[model samples]
Target: MVHVVLTGFMATGKTEVGRRLARILACPFMDIDSLVEVAAGRTVAEIFANEGEPCSIPRTAAAWPRPGPSCASRPDRKRFSGGWGTPRAGRSWRTRTAHQIGLRASRRCSPSAHLRMPLPPMRSTLPSSASTTSSSACAGSWRDGDGVQVVEAEARVTAEGAVQEVEVGLGPRSYSIVIGAGLLPGVGTRLASLGLHGRAAVVTSERIGALYREPIVESLRAAGFHPTAVEFPDGEEHKNLAWLAVLYDRLLEAGLERRSLVVAVGGGVVTDLAGFAAATLLRGLPMALVPTTLVGQVDAAIGGKTGMNHVLGKNLIGAFHQPRVVIADVDVLRTLPRREFIAGLSETIKYGIIRDAALFRHLEERLSEVLELRRDLLVGLVAACCRHKATVVGDDEREEGGGRMVLNFGHTMGHALEALTDYRRFLHGEAVAIGMVAAARVSRALGRCGSETVGRLERLLKRAGLPTEIPGGMTPTALALAMQTDKKSVDGRIRFVCVEEIGRTSFVELTAQEIVNHL
Candidate 1:
């Protein structure tokens, strides 16, 4: 299923366009900002005036992960279907048990997986007969005196399961990230709808290919495309110029051309190497991503940045090549090793720290469920991370401006540690866990954050079974030297991301001496 996501600066007609598009497609329309305003019991201008713009409504919207029934203060329990309702006095929006709404697909719709919108619409403008109630918020319908009822739309779930869609709005480069369980089998049918034809190259690691190759190849063959499987050794150590050269040789041997599609099906390592190859080989080839690991699904595969680690630093040699689509099958994550799964949490934690404080709280509250891979919680977590990533990537596709730099929350020391260890001692996420600690410490020392912030981060990382400190026998001096060669460094000064608080960060340049002082 395809979702049209409208995003831009304020007063950009995103809401109007979204409403019109929804009418044309006969789908539900949601305006997040309007929901925020209703929840706050104030207008957008008032919210901006009372609180800073940064603390305004959108942040509240980002916190919501799913749509459910909402409760209002009205005593009447009358339910209305497919129409507007009037608001009652002293009505306050609150969450209640979810009510099922069955929506039949229009003739224009195509058959595939069920499409669901995790976030439902909020209350809009009210009528004069109803008195305003104190500020409260909910996820579903809102009623007013003018016989206007605002009903939230729910996604259709089949006997199989439900599919959640997140839009990465890059204008012409935009694509949909489909997250759900058991999606790999239908990948072929989905690809066919995207206008892709000709041969397909599936780049994956030997380890992962052994488990998933047959299903993907079978799916492609069922969709009337010839798929060639290319396997490489699995490890960050193997992500180098030599392996890249090998992939190029393999693709050329397969008679791949510009019209052919490159399918990257593995963890972050495979995605980086394969995406880089697709970007450089034949100038560029259309690419699709199927990220298997938690790290890949939530972080690596969604962003357009693709590259292999350089001897000097991680991801130093790469290109900005966006994929045509990303299909994240949660079922595949069940095969991930425990350690790798824990490592992925580091990136998840990074997302919470950089933005989405509510996500951080959710992780803190549901760490056990997340670790156990509860389908409901895990799906929402993945969708939230993707939304955060899509927003950043849409704003800065190239990372030339500082907007995208916030994503490098912990990577300065993280990449340095990886290079210093020669990519052998620690997993990419492990090194990043340590790097985040170092960054938080620096932020505290520079008075950007309080000491409690550092402590909270250390405890969270530790709880996630991650290393929050430089490993024993590893010298800080070596890490500093490696950081000097980091891709983000300029004029020999290492640029660092400083955390002002959880969900708030800024970029700062620090000298080698100053970095050590924070440690």
Candidate 2:
């Protein structure tokens, strides 16, 4: 077998992604980290520090070179090569000049320089670059701040229009989050393919249901499902113990079972209540989350993690229950107000920060359409994010160690903010916006993150219509109390997840005051 190995500094999702790609390719995916751990009798961290890259890189490279056609004989063909970041101005100029000066240099010394520019902070888009040579057009996205994102979309003019699909794969349980203007017309039919049969419940808030209920209900009926629509009250205040009981009662009254399915159609609160109910009822039932808003589509629906909030804190009453499918209908976003759309962007930006730096770039270029809620782009944007979240979720399944926590890039202060606001003043995505700003500040305090990172995240938040700072009239004490009970933390230290640089992050334990001081 020709083994293809993936390498990066660390926590670049090599092991998790490699395994899944291997499965798709029908090949054995080996974990280099695990192998090194066993061989050197140490952890990846230990090996890097003790043996260093000078020794480790060669050892890793030595693991390659399977029996294949030698490069000497097949010099015309090339396998693969890719890289990241920028170069020192003078150094890059010299290399490019050298290539142009010598004819033989192109073969002997092929040089690619991705100059260091202020890229979109993890989660949004890179700024418009007239001079930047990205590996591919619309390569990635970067976060500007709170709800603000700079989405870069690449285009090359030609006779025939080319359609580049941005997508998300959740293994067999996967569904699409297409962001194109053409996606909304028949989403219910697309969802039915995953198996919504004679009976299905449409769980959403009354406010949201009022707007788009008819088409969805009709769609479900057309798909042969005995559709029943249930709309709870709107707002996070309703996402609590009392609301869940109502849903459970409604299901019972309808005589639903594990065989039947629950289709959550709305924002985060709707999905959380519906998903939690689906996870617990009959020891688990099939769920197809049709996230309407950006927040629901990008952040809430894809991840298996779901729960109603306790009076004490946000997401404290939750479970790690994977959905059978997540259909993020981007068309629903058109119905949303600008602020609501921005809230969704907040979560999308989170995906960029926690995972792909490239996603940030896409947002930068397409900021206008995204802000305008251009229906055409919604499906692709949502799908790209769904793929991002689904990939992490499939690998972790359960938040064991640091596997799933990466998804909580801004939730540390986010949850606390929601709790402090009584879950009414700010939407979940809005809270995340403020939370990310706070986290960036804390990162700066630790001497890890730079000022530019803070500015990028902050700007995105504003553009997305989210708050950058805590709301007025809230006590720092209540916020601190909320942080103490954050579900992701342990030993009551309020462990915050911080990104040292773009495309990388680390979990660090911090005190409530530490977070408060930044605020």
Candidate 3:
């Protein structure tokens, strides 16, 4: 039997743990680090030097061997499910029960494996509602009127960020997404600067109506355009065809012309619905995107893909409509919950993996600062991500080929997950996070990517408080059915975005069995 022989510095948690482990197993326990330290009090280095013994040792590709038996001997390798499944062997005998039963019996119980991550939690990224406050640390708790309970969130700044220009390329239909947080203060001024005219409307959602309506109305009036406010239902569940009509009817009622501007201020779903509405209304008007969720700032707000999901699939009804201006003010994120913020990071990390490899390096290097909401670091991170996404969108506005498909690196299964749950269980970014992990794993399994790359991606996603695999709610068969229902599926073949390596992704065809194997 393999037994773990702990080998580390003396001050490590070995001795206390050894005692407990020994007690549990009814076996002898040795604190080798303590024994080594006791034999060489001052320094093992000095003893090695005096004895003239070589410190360098043999190395192997595999893990270091135990001095005697291996750690494998201590316990059986348990195939444990996340918070939702059967209990398995753990570090301690009572660990499994202690972890799963530690919290309330509700669905909101934080997964033990999830919390053990070195990074933040998924629940922390989104707030319960729009009125949440910033905290001393990056993680902030939030509650909404509905009591949805996102826990922690980050509302990406709703203002134009650091970029000098907002690229709005559509060939005669092209416009710019201006970068600056205060662009909303003088919404008309910014729109007029872009050479827009007629009437202007602040298109918001019901949840954010109380907090953001009046200022926008006043801003449009100040800018010499007829200003009206339009608010839709709150939350991602209802971001669909029904809500798009509300904005359409309001724009028509306000007498908005082709030259008018539709200022969208809220979350990704809001921008998606409003952006698509503006695209269809008056044959596409100049619309300014003010993304309020972290998912919006770096990803959704800049991508120019707008639409609503169908019961059959996610984002099945969408248009490639570029916003005239995208304002990503960082200050707004303070109101978001910790979970929403972490969820948003999943997309930001996607940009890093697909385009700017340096972004991942920065994320890994400054994880603590990113979680802490360090303004300077976040500003730079947001800007860099925007630039990456903007460049990709600029190249392929309609998602014809390679450039646009890169965005789908993990979305194929992700959309399926969203469809399976009816978009209630996880946030968009959370789904993408799980999708990306599946992509990485599939990439490795299919010989397109390396195992280490998959491991790194999993570790990073977990650190960002994202899920690395499909949660227990969806069974393998159900997951297969959902994937089959994906809109991107062609000729009954489900396509997966497989990674060849870091920063390289490709669309690959797979059978339902292959996809099920991935889960």
Top candidate, metric lDDT: 1
Candidate rank order under lDDT: 1, 3, 2
Which scores greater on TM-score, model 1 or model 2?
1
**In angstroms, how far off is 44's CA in candidate 2?**
56
Task: Give a tens-digit lDDT track for model 1, residues 244-356.
Answer: 99999999999899989999999999999999999999999999999999999999998788988777778889999999999999888889999999999998889999998
Ranked by TM-score, the better of candidates 2 and 3 is: 3
TM-score of each: 0.71, 0.66, 0.66
* Displacement of the residue 357 alpha carbon in candidate 3, Å: 1.9
Find the 10 residues in a row with the least total lDDT in model 3.
Answer: 77-86
Residue ranges of candidate 2 with Cα displaced over 4 Å: 1-188
Question: What is the per-residue lDDT of model 3 for residues 1-519, given as tens digits with 9 covering 90 to 100?
Answer: 323322212122233333433332334554432333355563433433454222211111011223225554544311111111111222232231221111111222222222332321222212221112121111122233422232322233111122234464657756655443444576667767777766788888876667767877777787777878888777778788887777788889988887878889888888888888988987888788888778888888886788888887888888877676787766667667789999999988888777766778788788877888765456667767777777777788776765677878788778888888889988989999999888888777778888888887888888878887788767888888878877667788866778876776777788766877965
Model 1: pairs clashing at backbone N, Cα or C within 3 Å? 71-94, 84-149, 85-148, 85-149, 86-144, 87-143, 87-144
Report the number of clashing residue pairs per model. 7, 60, 37
lDDT of 1 at 340: 95
lDDT at 441, model 2: 82
